[model samples]
Each structure stands twice: as C-alpha cells, then as structure tokens.
Target: MFDSRHIQTFAEVVRTGSYAATARDLGYTQPAISQQMKALERAAGTPLFVRAGRGLRLTDAGQVLARHATGILSTIATAHGQLKAITRLESGRVRVCAFPAANATLLPATVARVAASHPGIRVELLEEEPPDSLRALREGRCDLALAFSAGHGGDAAEADGDSDEGLVEMPLLDDPLMVLLPADHALAGSSRAELGELEQERWIAGCRHCRGHFVAACAEAGFAPDIAFATDDNLAVQELVAAGAGIALVPGMTLPLLRHTGLVARPLAPAVGRRVSAFVLEGHETAPVTALLLRTLSEAAADMERAASGFPRSEA
Candidate 1:
C-alpha cells in the first residue's frame, strides 16, 4: 500500500533538501513536488518534514521511511535487471509438458538447440498425453505443451476440434497417419493401404487420447476395429506389429524413433495426418525461452516433414 512513485519523490526531496531543486532534478514543477510531499505524508499518516531555521529538516518518521525506501527501490531495480537478462536469453527456464512421441522427437531437438545456442536457458520436460498436458498448461504448471489430435495440417481451430477454449495454439507437425506392419505381411508390399482392407486384422492401438480417433476412422471405413492390444508406448506398438501380433496405426512423427528392421510403415490410402501442435497460455506465447523452444520444435518438424516427402511412408 505504499506508492513507489511517492517514495521515490520523497527520497529525492530528502536528498536535495529543497523543493525547487528536487523539482528541477526530477523534471517536475515546484508546486508538483510540494503536492507529492503532502500526498506522501498523508499516505504515511505522519508529518515527514518541518522548517528548522532557514532549511528543511526531517522528522523522526521521515528518517525511518527514508531508510526503508532505499532498500525497496534497490529491490525493484534488481528485479527489472533480471527480467531484462531473460529477455536477452542470458538466463531463463521453460517448463514443458508433451506426449511421448514429441518427447522422443521434437523435445530433444529443442533441448539440444537451447543448450548449444543459449546455454543460460534450461528446458524442463514432463511426459503426458494431450489431455493431461493441456490441463497442466491451463493450470500454469507448465509454460508450454505439445499435443496431437486428428487432423491433416489444418488450422488451429480445425486441428483442436474447438475443444481448447482459451490457449494460444501453434501448428507444428502435419504428420500423416500410417499403418505399421511386419515386413513380410501381404500389405507390406503395397505403396498404400486402406483401413477397410485391414478391417479383419487384429489391431494394436497407439496413444491413449488418439485411440478414439483411430476407432472412429475404422468405423467410418464400415467396420469396428478388433483392438487386440493397447499401449501408449510407440516402440512397444512397433515391436508387437513386427512380431506379427497385430498391425498398428500411428502418427508419422513417431516413425523417426523406430529402429526395428522387421516393420514397415505405410501411408493410408485416403491420407489423413495426425496434427501435432504447441500450446501456451494466451499471453505467454512471447515469453523468451518458451518462444525459442517453439521455434526449435517447428524447425525440427519441418526437417522431418521434408524427409517424409521423399517417401509416402515414414521410413525412419
């Protein structure tokens, strides 16, 4: 309940000991300085100055306030300086929450980039699916989040399905959904496969939040998927498929982390891509470390997208 401006004026007047001189130093008129002193005294509930012979002298309360004012102003200046350093990327931390696929692919690229380019910045990562990540972001537990939803590189509203009500969304990856199969499977030799063609096959579902979309896709193709296995682990899904347990439909973004030689990923014939995007609380999009991480993710996704252009399948 103390006004910083009034404190500053009081401190300046204390130092100068002359109303006219304090006004001249601070670029205010003499009467303005006099008014500020009166207002400051009223707020403090005590007389601060009195005439002693021909000069102004501080009352006991004035001396106490003057001592505290110096410390308050110093703390304020230090806070401003640290904020400026963050703006320059000299020191800061960005808290991130993202799904497993993004953690494996995009998150690492951002971490390495920040380490190499701005050593002062720290990236703290948490693994969660889209729903939990959005909840964490909305609650301010995380500064930024990476999520994927059913879409084909569409606009934010379309990709988000209008569910994200009050966050800033940035589209990162337009990764086509692909089916993973054993290398020797009959459809493995095909350039593209249709969901209806694999309707009778046992299915291994991918990420938890994305399972609903996959089920809907299968139903739209006129058959309900016989999901024999479910897991959020991309590698496990690939391993199950490679062992001929079941085929899995996965986002192309995850294919980069796969290393099993027995599996092949192919594009769906109708071509619907899973949309990966970044989200931040509305006003935090421009925060220095967060903005840097987003840019790094965008660039890394662009690289993966370009590689996928060489083949319709995500060939790792």
Candidate 2:
C-alpha cells in the first residue's frame, strides 16, 4: 500500500526539482523528504529520481508517477471540497484570488452578495496577478481565481487555450482598454484617440503585460511610445495621468473605481481588450460555495456591462 503523504511529497519534489525546496514547502526536514522518497521507491520497487549534478532528475518511472500524482491530488482536493460542502455551507471557507482591479470593483460586490446570503461562509481574498492566481488554484491554495487575459482581442476561446489543462475558465466579460489623459491635454476633448495620435507622448504602464500591449499597439501605429512610468496599480496610473505625468491605457472595468476628476478617458482605435474570467479547478466547480460565488460574479458582471455600455468608443 502507498501512503498518500509519500505520494504528496513525491509530487512536491517533482514540481520544485529540489528536496530542500520541497522540505521547505511541506515543513519537513531535507532528510525527512529523502526518507519519504525512499519509502515511495520501495513501494513501487523502482528508483524514481536520479541525482544529477547537485540536483535531481526524474527517471522514466518517476515521470509516469508524477503524471498520476497530479490526478491523485486533484481527486483528493475534490473529495475534500465536497466533504466540506456537506455541511450545507453553514460554516465553510472559499479561498479566492484575483488581480487588483477586480479586487477593487467586481469582487467586492460579489462578496457582498455572498455575505448577505451566506454569512456563515467565509470568502478569503488573495490579491495576485493572473499567473500567480492560476498557480495558487493548481496548487490547492485557492478554490477560485478571478483572472484576465489582456490584448487577446476579446476572444474567449483563445484565452481558454492559454490556460492550464487543470483549470476550467468561464468567460465573464470583455473589458476594453481605454486611453486616459489629463483633462486639459490636447486630445482630451476628442471622443476617441487613435494610437498614432499619441506617438510622441510620454506613457504610464501598469505591468509587463500592459507595457507589451502598449508597445505592440504603438508598433502597429508606426511608432514607439516613450514610457515614463511603470506600476502595477491602476489607481496610481490614474493619479499619475491626472498629475500630468503621462497618459495611460487602462481597462474599462477599473473606470468605476477611478476618481475621474482631473482625467478623461477615450476609447482607442483598433481596440484592444482583455477577457475576464472565473477559473476553477477542473472538478471543484460544483462545490456549493464556489457555485454561489460564481453566480454572484455573473450578476455583478452583468451590472458592469450595463454601466460600461455608455463609454466612448473610437469612430475609426
């Protein structure tokens, strides 16, 4: 018989590629991790890993076990979640992760709705970018992930293809990217701003993904923007634009949360946008709390869609 703990240790070691790192993750000593691996090897009657230069490599048998380990772990998580749900959700917790803008706008409303109806169910929020959020979901650290795919031209299928096989993405909304400029700036009075119109302007970008999108849009417009500021905070991006630091391309979902006093936003020509989605592990979507939260999220997204309907769009 194989011990599930040993299986778990094997999977962690395989994932981190270091016994020491796995020990740190599982709160066990390095020697303890080695002992677990040895026990697992004896159960399988074959060596699983080969020592290679100060590191370790999985043998062929180890590779096969690693593949099965993923399924085993996922099944265990599903069972655990279902067991928790058997309490009628009178007392349970759902771990959720999302990017900043969603945390500010969408998630709060969804959480409010959940709290009103299921006060006994706790929803914990972890602020993480899409990559980290997805990682948390796969690693069993988070039950749900509110993530977005930027610069995907609003194609949900394309966005789904980009996610891991262990995750199932449910598209919620298409968030268009808009240009934010100082209220008295040259192009602020216009209902729209073409990418080419900002060729010589200084830019503020939020992240590497946002910067890449901005640079790509500029390239398509036949020029490169001089990016003057970089940050991951959308509110700070708006404040900087309001302060006349530089213009920025921001997602429409963040508009409701912005002060919008000293800045004006216009849609960009040849529009680029992000696809926002609710991601769950492959089989945990049926968990009661997860389902309720997802339903509330869908309702909140509908409200957002209605509110954003009046936003300006480029004429080109």
Candidate 3:
C-alpha cells in the first residue's frame, strides 16, 4: 500500500520538477524527499523518476502515477471538506461553474438564498461556457455546473455516455433567443421578427456557439446575416444595438438582466431557445448543502420564468 504522504510528495515533485524544490515547498530535506521517492519506487517495483542532466524527469510509469496522484489528492481534499461539513451542516464549500448570463441572473439570487438558509456553506462561482463548465464537473474541479443546450438535446447530462462519472442533470429553463432592435428601428413596432425580413440589416453575432445557431437559424430562413460585430458580452451587444450598430439575437434570459435602455427585444417567429440545466455528480445530490443549493437554484429558475412572462412586450 502506498502512503498518501508519499504519493503527495511524488505529485509535488512532478509539479515542481525537482526534488530540491519539492523539499523546499513541503518543508522536508532533499534527502527525505529522495527517501520517499525511493520507497514509492520500491512499492511499485519501478523507477518512477530518471536523472535528466542536472534535473529529474518522470518516466512513463511515473507520468501515469502522477496523473492518478493528482486526482487522488483532489478527491482526498474534497472528502475532507465533506466530512467537515457532515459533522455539522454548519460549513461546506460548493464549487460551481456557469455562463455569464446565468451568473448575472440565476446565480446571484440562488446564492443569496443559499447563504440566507445555510450561512456556513461557501459557494465558489466560476464563469465558464457550457462545454468548459461540463468539463470542470467531469474532472471534479466543480461540484455543480450551470450549462445550456440549444437544439442539440434536452439535457447535457443525458447526452454524455460517461455514466461511470455519475453525473445527474436537471432541466432548469427554456430560454428563447430573441431579436434585439434599436428603439426606432423599422421592425421595432412588430411583436416578433422573421429571420428573412432582417437579411438586409447589419447583425451582431454572439459567442461562438450562439453565432453558429444564428447562422444556422438564418440559413433555414433562406438568407445570410451581414455580421458587423462579434462578441460574447450580452450587455455589449445591447449597447451596440442601442447605438444602431446592428441587430442581434440574444437569449431571452438576458432581457431582465440588462439595465440598458433605448433597445427593444422581440421574440423570433419560430422561437429558438436554449435549455438551461444544472449538472451535478450523482452522489453529490444526497449531500445536505448540495441539495439545499439545488433547491435554491430551482426556485430561482422558477422565479425568473414567472418574472419573464410578465415582462413588457415590445410595441410601437
């Protein structure tokens, strides 16, 4: 059996690339670091590191062990945190990744609710796109991921074949993409806009994924948009529209989040929307803090949907 201390020492060596550096970081003598490495090698019956000039390099076996060691260390840290929280639901940390709009709208309210209910739990939020957020969840870097899928499928969790990773996805909302027009634009008087009608107008493209959807949606309408600017910031897109730069297709959820004036948003004739969802590792759902946060997020999503329905419709 390999000691976790030795495994951690090995991982540190791989990261720092030198026994002397590892010793300095871990407060151990260089000889002690060497002793641990040798013991680790003896246990595995292979040389984990090879002398390369003045420094050291991991052998193939060492590289594999280092990879596993990093994961093992992360798991141990997470287990320690959970155990600490289990002792008393008083304190725990939940790492979450979300896209920008969700961060602005959904996460703040949800996090506030979680904080009010469980003052001891700390929620760390990271802004990431859907793919990156899902990757973080799969790699154990985050406990939960707020992600979205458009026309591709229902839930991102169900779309993955890595059941062994034990991911559970819950659908949150169907946030439609809407057309944003300058307040005095010719189409601003309409309740909705067709893609074909805007063929002559300059356009502002969204993020890469959203731009792809815009392109595909426009192609389906038998015309291509004249994209004038490409950006991921919804607020920037709105600002540009207000300045009459170009029209844009923005997610409906962003409407309430935007505080900017002088622009009107109308639903698309054949509404296109993204389905937002929360993804968590299967076993995490049972944790008290995680469960509470999940419930809070659900409540927030419901509230947003209700509020969105009452939002003033664009008119002349």
Instruction: Please tell me which predicted candidate would have the highest lDDT against the true structure.
Output: 3
Q: Cα lDDT of model 1 overall?
A: 0.83
Off by over 4 Å in 2: 1-87, 152-163, 311-316
Candidate 2, residue 82: CA error in Å?
11
Give the alpha carbon lDDT tens digit for every residue of 218-290 in model 3: 8888888899999988778878988989999888888876567778889998888888899898887878777
| Ten contiguous residues with the weakest lDDT in model 3 | 155-164
Higher-scoring candidate on lDDT, 2 or 3: 3
> Top TM-score: which candidate number?
1
Models sorted by TM-score, best on top? 1, 3, 2
lDDT of 2 by residue, 258-299 (tens): 675777888888787888899999888887888888888999
Worst 10-residue lDDT window, candidate 1: 151-160
**Model 3 regions lying over 4 Å from their true place:** 1-88, 152-165
